[model samples]
Target: MNSCKVIDEVVNKGLCIGCGLCVSACGNNNLKMALNEHGFLEPQQVSGHCEGCKGACLSVCPFNSKPNNDISTETKLANIFINESKNHNTSIGKYINTYAGFSNEHRVNSSSGGIATYTLIELLARKEIEYVISVKETITTDSHYAYSISSTRDELLAGAKTRYYPVTLAGVFEKIKELDGKFGIVGVPCFIKSVRLAQKADPILETKIRFLVGIICGGVKSTFFTEYLASKAGVDVAEYRKPEFRLKDETSTASDYSFGCLDKDNNQKTIKMRMVGDMWGTGLFKSNACDFCDDVTVELADISLGDAWIEPYRSEGLGTNVIITRSILADDIIKKGIENNALTIDNLPISSLIESQRGGFNHRHNGLGFRIKKRRSEGLAVPPKRFEKDELSFLLKLIHLMRMKVRKKSLEIWKKTKSAEQFDKRMKPYLFLLSTLTKINHYYKWYSEPGAIKASLIRKKSKIFK
Candidate 1:
């Protein structure tokens, strides 16, 4: 079978994130994004269409690792915002200012303070963009949500809340070609980066896309993630409809939210995410591409939004958003919102914004380094990352390895057994080992601290006995 470079380099290596930029970038229409056996979207090559191809798909692929063909996210941001942005950092990238707050109007229905939704709406209201391209629920049963074009306030509002399930941009890119107006897109870091990469390779996209709004993401889950959750919640997967990944309870804190889904009969079932247990941190069902990604703040985006997963905001049931504004226009819209009382926000120190996503940074930064090193040691190809491979402690290495195993095997085990119990049983040994190592590393660091008085006391007592 003939294949595109993307298939041989990314998809075959398990690094495809299903962003679908490859499908949209294929000038010959040689590729189509389809759901694979693992329930993640990937580009499938059409026979005979790749003849004399110029490799546009590989050029735009986020996971593409072709030597000297790679365009780093940092370079992309500098090319666009070097003079516009006031600050830059390795972790958060370029930014004019960082803020922590939420839209007064959008917080109720939003997953996290509605900052992203509010920003997209304001950009439309201000006539900055002709349309907003974002993920929204579809009427069809084949997929719950897909990327859509929305120009109206109600349309944008209907697309609110977090969607953990996988989605691709193949459809929206096609729509962008048919539509004749400027557009703004909302996406996660990897998706936003892919769009930027596409724009560089395709002049048409560069002219049409006006703004990029980014979501601070840990990783995306496969469709099986939803099925597993629904199955555990006693909702019939066959009838699962209108699944809402984040449903807030006024009595509880922002992070303490529930997952809600509707049955065929329209009955809604709700379950707290905590009840689902440690799926996010444990990397269950996460795309392997996520393990290779290092961009946490969507550095290429004009502005980025994330759940303020810290402090008083965490305790606030209404939800809060941590934002990083990298473009002047994005900053202006936010400042105008503050002036009009449309938003209630505070200027956040960059440190505070970074702290809000400390776990994400640890994984993308430290954990990523370990994974790259391990892959290279095995003589396997790995995607190019911003940070170099790190020499990690043995325990840290074990923790990272266990995470990689969980992400890879979750889908495999689910595909075979389709039973959450079996999945959990198979995962127990990995989880148990990980948990033990984590505790040991934690205490070891604590006792190794310079002022660990308990350590000092123990040493003194032992010396006296000797």
Candidate 2:
């Protein structure tokens, strides 16, 4: 089918990730990406006339068809330049090496270890790539962030931290088509996958996009997330100007979120993240498409980077990255950076790297089948997934259902919330539902299984007594 079919099935079905590949692939400026009432970035047809052109847009869309192919299929299809796999994990696909590291200069100010920023800068410095595309704060709006092209180290640094908001490649793809040069792009798994699909359809993209740097994603938040935070922080959503998430706090254990806007007196007002309520865990503003995805490590990327959420690294206030390199070029760059003292790195077991994002993996992979089944039971359409259907334990099924319930109710409650206190009051029951599931999962894991407590103690003692 054509772009129209794609809109009817994926976009209308709420399965669109808003990557904007379809808009670019349409090739006639027939489609444009814009924010919907739900604050999701979606495509709308600008021209009603059908050019009767061949539909390349449908083939390039990642969500157009069921992604039922195995991990090996993705690796084999995407990793055309790499042959051998050095390490493998069920959740984190083929990798040449895994490491924990940080950029000496950027660690403190970055959201994580700053490896992603450093790697992009290194590529630019060596002239390996002429330009890099990433996300940076929007100068004109109080909206969170937007896609930008960075040719200099300072420009790259400006986009360094994790944005945690929805960004699209419609503009970036237009620029790539116009400009002629080697390029590197940083994005989440689905975005990278869409780029690969576009590259297969267009030869110029295949040649110009020399590198793909993926960021491990839990999911992306919508503009509603920012608005919700603004409201909680006492800033009027209508008056809110600009917002930043994961603001660096050298003294605090976790990063804070903040926003700036002019008050009635025309004085600039700023609000910190704490007042906005718990953005994480609640999963209130997460895109629906994210729930259907299973690629937590961005397996299709040349190199994937994320926070080292496991012990030792997690305790360090400066932050650290769990890096998985799939391309020889990425491995070499990281190796050289370590050699020159630009980065501090150490080889870590693939297991440790997987452990760093255990929660994300469990939810995205293991819990996905149940979610799919739930949708199907309701006669709802679902995008195809690689995960196989398996019977979940009763408690696990209940937990999954509870999470969905909480997610749905939280969105409704957010719109009606008049004050932070009311927001918290209404959200308490839903949050309690999540907390109860967490406790049940923990208790079931340790108490229900024979010797589970003993095994846990041994693991803890081994770490401490070592």
Candidate 3:
């Protein structure tokens, strides 16, 4: 690894695909991708995770757009689909024939499925909700965060794609007064809690809200990852203008990506950045904030969406989704839409979802694995005495580390192939060195601070006391 590698700027308001290449790269046990509030897996920083490695993680990030302050969003299309689905379609308001890429695409490009996003878009089109209460990208001096708030279709679509940043409903609650009227939302479990709190705080919202959609995220990132990326892309952090993650794509996979921005010269620059097996789970492309998160399934929301990590669909390009309807009203809308030929429907299970999607908190967060390790350390768990003859642990650790490095290196090579070959070649080594010293909170670093830590222990303690 180069010692003088360049580090990217902090990313505040976007998603991380959670691929885990960085974890593979680090010979030292400093980096890991863990679950966040929403359930999706993300990069985390263990105290000693980074062995002064830089290029491995930073080079692999696909979302880091040029940071800009002049960013903005507004509403787009708003047309109703009366009855435009098929026999397989289940609900009128639940699916959209108007949109080419909707209707149970859950078998295709999504996490759990395509239903939740479709649901949100349908409500917006029907004008049932004036704005989708969601997280829009935010720019802070240090980095950008996907601050929670209300969003129009244009805004939501613009903000689409995974943003590995921490999102909270508290911010969205503050923005709700301006939206005022029937509204929908897309968020994680914690965000749903915040929304419930907001509704409790205001009686009108209880009436005004028409729908709620939650994403099954593993964790969120800090703004530091964003800034670090921008800096590496030859974009100046001080003169940064705006940042956009997952700049729209017909292809849902992370591999087919294009970056866009107006450079310091006010000239627009777009870059095609794509690779194989690109998903948010890559540890190389995540935020440190993820490790602290505890929720993954989005229990508080009426509906939740994610990718269906199943075989046939997972093989079909990367831009698909999965959806789960938990609320009666949500189920009604989807069901009605399907019956009216406005959408399609399907019955599914939680396990099927976990296996198909990337890292969510349910089975993906390493919760089970962590428990196993903890038990093993405590002597509550043990290897077979016959197997104890060999220290398989060291071999397993070595394999994991080496694999991560190979993946990280492969990604770096892929990126340079698209950019200036010579320039990127020279820069990669330097950037590798820089990425070592350069640490970010969201995409690459994992945190252990007690301030934002989530705990089941607290709940258990309260129950025990009771």
Candidate 4:
């Protein structure tokens, strides 16, 4: 197929995740990442630069399903770190060590645990890497953040917090080509996979990008997601500026942080995330590409980091990070930091790390299987996935289907109304149904567990006595 045709299949068919590897990997420079009408970055053809080509671009796409060229993240991990890693699992991929901790200095500034920020700082301090490529505030009328390269300590720290908004690596790839230095990139799983694919296709990228730092992502959101939240916080989308998606709430738990943004007048507006409701679970403005993804912890990254959502860590007002280190060098850096008292951390079982991101895994793995099967049954284009077709209970399947509907419809509804109130009014039924079904599923599982019947009987007996 021609380059245009290949990209059309991916983009038109809703399979493109917009990482921009295809643009960077193109020898003809035929593609560029552009913001779509829905406010998510998508690769658009530069012009009529048409040519019949082998699968150079799609070969690197994490969602590509073409034969031979369609490489799995598992295969990449096996080829690169299989012999070096101390353990391997289908859920989290290969790892040398797992830990949970926070950096005393960086935690306050970071979204969670501060480990990712600290690691990037350490890599720079040790002169192991000359620069760090990460997300930072861009503050345009249309966008609040984008991928940027950081050279100084303060720059990395400025890029510390998590950004759920969609960003593409196309521009940064050109920047990497222009600048000369060793670099470490931080991104979500699919973006990291794209970098790996691009590196395989481009020699310069392979040499320049020395480390991959991954952030555990549930799914990326379109600009509308933030706009919706900003609107709910009483800021107009046109007036929105300098968004802070995760503002720590000292009086509440780690996960109960607030969302803050600057209005047109430069006044800060803040709202507790809980007050905005659980939009994340509802999949509001989530990319269609996310429904097809299966990697939960960036299994292909050198080291993956995420919020520690279990137990004491979750209770801590300052966030905690659950980390999976795949490379020896990455693990050694953590160890050195611990020894120097720059970090306070403890080795955690890999299972605990997996539990911390259980919600992500459930959606990416089980939900992915169901989505793939449904897409195939409808003769729709399904992206290549690491998981096989999974059989979910009828209720679960319906809930999953509802979530897909919610994600798909949210953008259209928001665009039509442009009013958060109208959007919420239209989506109430879907949310109510999804919430009710999810509660049923949760209760059913709770009651079906082993010893649950005995426990329930004891509770009943105690209630009668009381």
Candidate 5:
């Protein structure tokens, strides 16, 4: 096992899990991951110390990173579709819930509604999976890395939310060979795409990974942002250990106080901040990888879930999912669950869901591929779809900027909320962009203008990325 190979796998595959175990294990400076290409977070070499230890990295690797199988069949997707939807927005087959939700551990602790955690839990509870090869922060450090934690229902309850610091994909890479039962994975769009790429490179993953749960994301940042929030809170910084971002006790309003964290001795450290409604890429502390991301939502995942952040459907202090089950199995499970009253939902159209997700905006990355294709089809090395302030592109950049700015405020709000419902009133306005524009409407959140212009010119030189 070459260190370069391992590092490349970790970087490109990006299951890093953010454990920092490899950093400790690497006797040589040969290994490190410091803001690489696309920059959602990847591992790199400080020099080449990790260059020689193939097996060593594996020894310390957490997630059993093995490629499973290709479920890219219409039959599978169709089956899930048929099974989960109960005529309206859910699958009807053997479901126990209308939609999958677990206000359990991961949700209350998560950035969005904690749906990803619940999805994994549902899989485990149903015996559809053996262990989960997802990323988690180890007890020892704030850094995250992948770990193939076995689920007994109990373990699933333990990790149901989001970890902002680091997520290690390498751990999964190390332990994959030992597992036998089907597994599941949850990640932001880029990570899901990377996992898809990994499946292409190594087929074993497709066989084992029964579910690829995707979360719509803006991007991820370093632990620095959490630190930033904590610093503003007037807490004793030196005593910090592990920090949980949100804490709630079922109250509503400013005095209710939604977010908090924990330190080394399990002391609940509560801090407060301002609020906003958006989740994912607001770009304040997000990695550069987000800018170049081609997928706003990983279309390939078995199931894609995200906050329904648009209009009439949004509950101020709580969370609702704009769920799209890629296949029928997922659909069926959800459908049955709802009919059985194990789940509850508000029927939503795909358009409503998309609006909630703030779709329609284009960016350099969005136009990039089409730019390349347009160039290729037109007989050019690179297309010349340079950014323009014309109606379309101008609006695209505007929306992107607004999304970022709102999310920056949102991180502050999230740190203070715990209501499964009752979000700030300003957060639930539909048609945020259109509402600001001459009156359009959205599913949730207030809309204004796509006002910022940091790299407004980048849209101009997109073809010259090389």
Candidate 6:
């Protein structure tokens, strides 16, 4: 139940989500979070003076095994937080309400609807929370991002957009423990889960963390993704000044990915969404641990927010948010915001929320099962997951396998490329193969039925005959 045990069980097994709660749990400053060569945040023990008197680190790690009797207890606690009876979909978890909306003030500058920034501002204005912990660009290093604690409006605004790189809460958690008041936190599902786990072992965290704001996530990428994007934008990673992901463009689709960078000469450069290659599909520079994650929506948060990728809303380039309120506090805040005219929103069916993240749900829930099975077949150790064994079509299995393989190749190619053009040229064939396989898989699944082809033919013939 020491650092050694955590390394053996979680870090080595690739179950560590790199949330960095374990570092904060060790009060003696024995561990520090550092990014490895592959851009993964991992704990590095500074001092070996481990008496193992109290295994606070092990108790807080989400990946650790719990006794069989404790399963029901944990589930019951989760149900209490989730208000299980009100939940409509398992993928999205429990929510008091769902809505599509945007913050009038922050939408243009934010990655999505700006609800997260608005929510933090409201909480601060009401004196309900003293500080918020969120991710922001590191001032000294343009190629890196880090967790920051914001207490003022400008500070909150500075950290508004989505960060698509690796980040951990070890440093911020330390700051929270040092300071005195209630705080809100923003994180993806895995990081939120880590906070919940850490709270069980540390009573102070239970009292300090007054709110949890979660962002729905597909998966976290390695630092390599940032370097790749910088390379594609015609900036050397070391010479880049500041880089922002998801630079909002009013003319682009909500799903379009873009990057903005400043070079040493203070010249601005941008890689438009079209020229950046496929960010999600190719899965370049993705973390190994992300492949095993099952949570698409941040189920454990007080409230969760994500881009509303459905029609009409998706067409709006500023971006819209699909919000799910879980705790009563969050639900009340959202309702009051709408009533006060601080936000624009309309009620949305829970189905739309699920549909907005359909790809993520399928990959995390179903694709995870296939990935786990494949690992087991190869005599590799895999952590337990909730998804049951299901039959995978031949094409579906091949698509998943190839996606993983191509991602590794993409990382290699990215390292070798000296410029954006070279990276794009080298990646064309691999990207094409992945896209074609995905299309074929979907087409076969839908059109392979007997009447599907016949119906298509009849429609075409009717149009021609008319």
Residue-level lDDT of model 3, residues 246-328, one tens digit each, is 45454554334454444588764444445212224333433432322334555445665665445445544434455555555
Please, what are the lDDT tens digits per residue for candidate 5 over residues 73-131?
Answer: 22232343224433332211111122324333454455555666666777887888877
Clashes of each: 0, 3, 117, 0, 100, 0
Candidate 3 TM-score over all chains jointly: 0.49
- Which sections of candidate 2 miss by over 4 Å? 1-3, 66-73, 79-86, 142-144, 252-278, 416-419, 450-466
Q: Candidate 2's error at 96, in angstroms? A: 0.6
Superior by lDDT: candidate 4 or candidate 5? 4
Cα-based lDDT for every prediction: 0.83, 0.76, 0.43, 0.82, 0.48, 0.77
lDDT of 1 by residue, 365-425 (tens): 8778888887778777876677766868888888888888877788888888777677778
Q: Which window of 10 residues has the lowest lDDT sum in candidate 2? A: 65-74
Model 4, 1-466: lDDT tens per residue?
A: 3447547678888888878877766667788888888878888877776675565667667777653433455555346533468788888888898999989889998899899989998889888889899998885655678889899998888899998788888778778878878999998988888777777667788788888899988788998888888888889987888888999986779989988888989999988888877777788899888888888888778889999998779989889999888888799989998999999998898778887887887888877788888888987876556786687889899889999989988998998877889988998998889888887776676567579655754554542333
Q: Quick one: ranking by lDDT, best first?
A: 1, 4, 6, 2, 5, 3
Model 5 alpha-carbon miss at residue 309, Å: 1.2
lDDT of 6 by residue, 253-369 (tens): 787757988888999888886666567756777777778766687878888999998877888889999999888888878899899988899899887888888788788887888
RMSD, each candidate, Å?
A: 4.6, 3.8, 18.2, 3.3, 11.5, 4.0
Error of 4 at 160 (Å): 0.9
Model 5: ten consecutive residues of lowest lDDT: 89-98
Local distance difference test, candidate 2: 0.76
Model 3 stretches astray by more than 4 angstroms: 1-117, 124-128, 137-162, 165-172, 175-182, 197-210, 231-234, 247-255, 258-260, 266-289, 339-350, 361-365, 368-466
Global Cα lDDT for candidate 6: 0.77
Q: Top model by lDDT, which number? A: 1
> How many clashing residue pairs, candidate 2?
3
